[model samples]
Target: MQRPNYPSGKDLLSADAVSRFDLDDIMERAERHLREEEMEKAGHALPEPPAPRRRPKVIATLFDQRSTRTRLGFQAAAARLGHQSIDAYDTDRNRIGQTTGESIEDHIHTVELYSDLLVVRSHMEDLPYRVGRLSYLPVINAGNGADEHPSQALVDIFAIRQMRGPIETLGIALSSDTRARFAISFVKMLKLSPPKRFTLCCLPDAPLNPAMREAMTVLANLGTAIGIVHDIRQTLDHDVLSIQMQDMSKFAHAALGNEAVDKEKESEPFTLTARKILDARSDTLILNPLPRFSELDTSCDSLPNAGYFRQVQLSVPMRMAILERMLLGIPWTGQADSFPPSSGG
Candidate 1:
């Protein structure tokens, strides 16, 4: 076929048309609309329930990484929306490690034939984006590498917004090995005028992983005040903290380059002590992505301002929105057509 005469190169907006259209930006706007709809659903409008859309679909939950709450949240969200969820085991279950290298694109294509949406948690960061581009169905990034956990980030942001209202100015204290991974998700959440500050509290010897360093640079350019501190004492200045502490005893020899007196002595307190810091801020929000060891004191849970439990609760509604978007292709915009005519309500 002969190509028609095209507009002159000078008339083109830019060399990269894809740059003009960002998938993440679109998804972020959609998320905001859904959140508002959820709020309306929970408000005084609750006496008349909104008619649920009938979109029968199947969601594939592919996990190559360890997950507890994430798996359950996605499953529950799918069920609530009357969708089927298929749990796919690791690639090792198939012959990927054998004769033919099962490429991500191939694996996604095969799964897309069976399911309407793909929710994947992989050990490699690039895998999700690769599959999203190749797959016909919507691809949700559950957790990727030590990189982004978009769902977790969304839920966390929802929790913060619920507790503190809009996050035009906010503070977050993130600690430990997974900081960089969570950082990617958190930075996107900072689109609400960007966080006033983000403090990293790590052990003096523990350096942030490479991915985290890159995330910090990116966030800094976006007007977020990023700081790395070796002590939690510095974090007391911040109002909210989402903490993750790690035991470095295993890598102590290599990373620390120190032959400690005793292994027993190495078992120092990894948990945050709140008794002293509690007085620092009148209304402090403490969050630990659970399964915490000594990183967070249990007694602090009883405090009046403790919002960690609230964070976990917010995950349900957030996940519901995500499943609706990815599996059922529900529009996130709160436009009139997004929901059926509401006489039933």
Candidate 2:
């Protein structure tokens, strides 16, 4: 059989190229292949698939920002696929941001000689585009200053797909850290159908971040409804996926306010309790981006439909497919051809 002719990283330079990178491309085609043949084999189930194990080159992680899951997840994904990850933290370390302030272009050009890809996390929204203009290697915006975190969105979708059946009209409630809010925001924006509706349930002080707002723009274009409410009850009315984002800064208030706890005392509601979900509907699925706080009640764990922990477990396989594609350079575009025509398009 002929091997898949995947699009090179250079193909992403055009906005029209999105059809080439759409998640459906991964879900229908790449994911099937990875699950069937290419997933990493170890103590898990299958070893690495028959496809080439090692990446054609190295990836320089130029993280100008901080992250635990994004950074570590990428590193873990790269290693699982037999790729090398070079951590370039400071200009003192990589000399890109310091020492005469070498242009990002120059730094990218310099690194391209040794690396096959660049994973960048910047504070500026347009920085990825500017750097992409200069780099010859594939560029992944790890978290481009809240404008977008496509990879996280992809993983979140992957988790949802595993836990629930379909998402065309799926609704999600975000009760997470500001960082994770961007991922939910992007999903609302870029989704072809977008979520029917989404709710923002955070303390008044911990509102959605700037990038989250950008994602909301995408949802707005789709005419998808969005509500920014101080409470979760407003959102539980829908077929909900609760994304509990844990930020240490917000943990202090976890014990205060809300109906689950007595207002006279310092206690918060059990956001993910079975009782809470049962009040809404039994099928309500729980989701968390990981590193959780006390907001999610432990009682939900015994319920058959409880899915947050399963959401975390699903990340391994979803990431396995992503690593196979990025490192092996799988062309996710095949779905446009592989599946029969659908009326939705």
Candidate 3:
């Protein structure tokens, strides 16, 4: 396939990398893919698959953390696109993390030669950036230590747009850890299409993550009516509420095996329940990136407000769109012209 020329780089390391135009393009592609699937499922005739690539593209996943959805979603998306994925990092079998392991430079050099694109998830905040600098292949940051999950943000925006309506007309609330990677990416990506009202429901005592603060500042400057509230109830009037656990550091540490998992209950003020939704008489759509903790009550599962499961369903086509665009050499032009260096937060 012939490649398209775009000034933006091939790597999607941060939500900052996607421009409004890039986001629209991606969403259009995802919607098209989704429509075709729905049509096929309805027993409608569809065009035949294109001829296979002589050298099918390889997507290399280097996840140094545990996952369920993101991992399988990308692998499945690749298969649908006639591509394959390789687990590039294996702590037990690979020399990368051994006592006398090869340097990251050496490891990436070898991995880049074998793969056409790299999707990275790491506990280290800068690992993806480091890999992006080292590899010629397109790099997608699956998730990074309290940094950002840009793709998840894309999935989320796509979900909201699909389920609710245009984002610009919506009142969106995020009830999550201020440092959560997905939250950071979500807010950052929102700068592309600022919502009418953006409210944050977080712990009253905790300071906002610097990365999140900066991203929100961008949205505020874009004319989004930004508000910060301590209770989830305060956000119930919004059209959508994207939620997650409050303290991500505890989970991050547990994922790194540095400590036992924290099983502490979510704070009452932050938790969202069906009763609360009913009592408030609000019809806010609820969204959670799963492996959900107590913050999202199961009581809300059957409620009309629940949209996380549908969010997961929408992720497949989004992933397919991302892979298809990058594989076609279309660069993301969503980044600001005067982009500053990431502090690795």
Candidate 4:
């Protein structure tokens, strides 16, 4: 069968799609938007006003999983861009996945007709890929099942840049589940602006995740000094440390009643606390994709190093930048025609 002729607009399906040039452009746009917002907040009139669009664009969000940040972030971004948004999929109102429902093809075709862009978040890893193949409308993979949350990674990088400084000069550490979608995307995206030193603080005895291992190898090849340590303390000396709960698969399986929750406290060794930072007298800028669990202790909230809340705030402009760029039909220059098997997630 012949492949459908996709539109010139790009789909941001993976961090690997973004190039250093793309990153620079997006970051510049985001910084400009943030400055404009700050100026407006200070009651300063702009020297040049935003040109109104001939017709307001519509952004359709097809999220099969629960979300608080990604959904609102895009909606806010669309509104800021003088566009509209619609929740394209609602299990309560839509029948796309029901026995009596329309097929995904029919649903996507209908959505593409109504919207200019499609933002997808699903527990199914392949949903965004399937949608990208099925529809000509540009698709943004909000989050896929333990696969890649590329947009969130962009937000994270933006936060780090804004809070710390240039990406290439910093020593960065990630304390997370090796299989985490965000972690995978984070490490992959780092290749565009390789850090001075990159560290992975994860389980000691467990073998590295294939996807993560591949991403780290790319960074290593790029001359990033990569280290793997069992304890979070080993990473405390780094300029920035991004952290999340470990072994999400175990928690997910437990939640689904597939198996008993492991009584073993694996996270203790990896958890970050204010006490540790204070005792070490470290100045590491701490970041977390929120809805944080026990992995990030609340005691760290008052510390100057805690940047997660600010990280959340920075996501708005970054999201706006993404929508703005994609709407212009600019494709990511670095995207491969086909991703390698090891980079699937």
Alpha carbon lDDT of each predicted model: 0.59, 0.57, 0.89, 0.88
Among all windows of 10 consecutive residues in model 1, the one with the lowest summed lDDT is 9-18
Question: TM-score for all predictions?
Answer: 0.70, 0.67, 0.93, 0.92
User: What's the distance in Å from true for residue 31, model 3?
Assistant: 0.6
**Candidate 4 per-residue C-alpha lDDT over 195-246 given as tens digits, one digit per residue, 9 for 90 to 100:** 9999999887777889999999999999999999989999999999999887
C-alpha positional error of residue 345 in candidate 2 after TM-score superposition, expressed in Å = 41
Query: Looking at candidate 3, what is the lDDT of residue 124?
Result: 82
lDDT of 1 at 288: 66
Return the TM-score for candidate 3, rounded to 2 decimals.
Answer: 0.93
How do the residues 1-345 of candidate 3 rate in per-residue lDDT, one tens digit apiece?
A: 333342347889889889888999999999988988898889987686568779889999998888899999999999988899999997557787567888888899898789989999998888888887667788899998888899999999999999999999999999999899999999999988899999999888999999889988988999999999999999999999999998877875345434457567999999999999999998999999898999999999999989999999999999999999999989887562323355542
The model with the greatest TM-score is 3
**Residue pairs that clash (backbone atoms under 3 angstroms), model 2:** 40-47, 41-46, 41-47, 41-48, 146-211, 176-245, 189-218, 189-219, 255-267
Off by over 4 Å in 2: 1-17, 33-56, 90-92, 99-103, 176-181, 188-190, 202-228, 244-275, 278-282, 293-306, 320-345
lDDT of 3 at 71: 95
lDDT of 1 at 267: 27
> For each predicted model, how many residue pairs clash, with residues at least 3 apart or on different chains?
2, 9, 2, 0
- For residues 92-112, what per-residue lDDT tens digits would candidate 1 score against the true structure? 465444566665546666787
Question: Which candidate, 1 or 2, has the higher TM-score?
Answer: 1
**lDDT per residue, candidate 2, 1-345, as tens digits?**
332333445322222223424567656543564464333333345543346754445767877765677777777666655677888556335555565566666676677678777778776556666656555456666665544566665666666666665666677666655555344434543455467777666666765666567666767677768777665556566665565633433332232113242222112532566777778665767676655556666787887776766665555555555555555555334221222122230
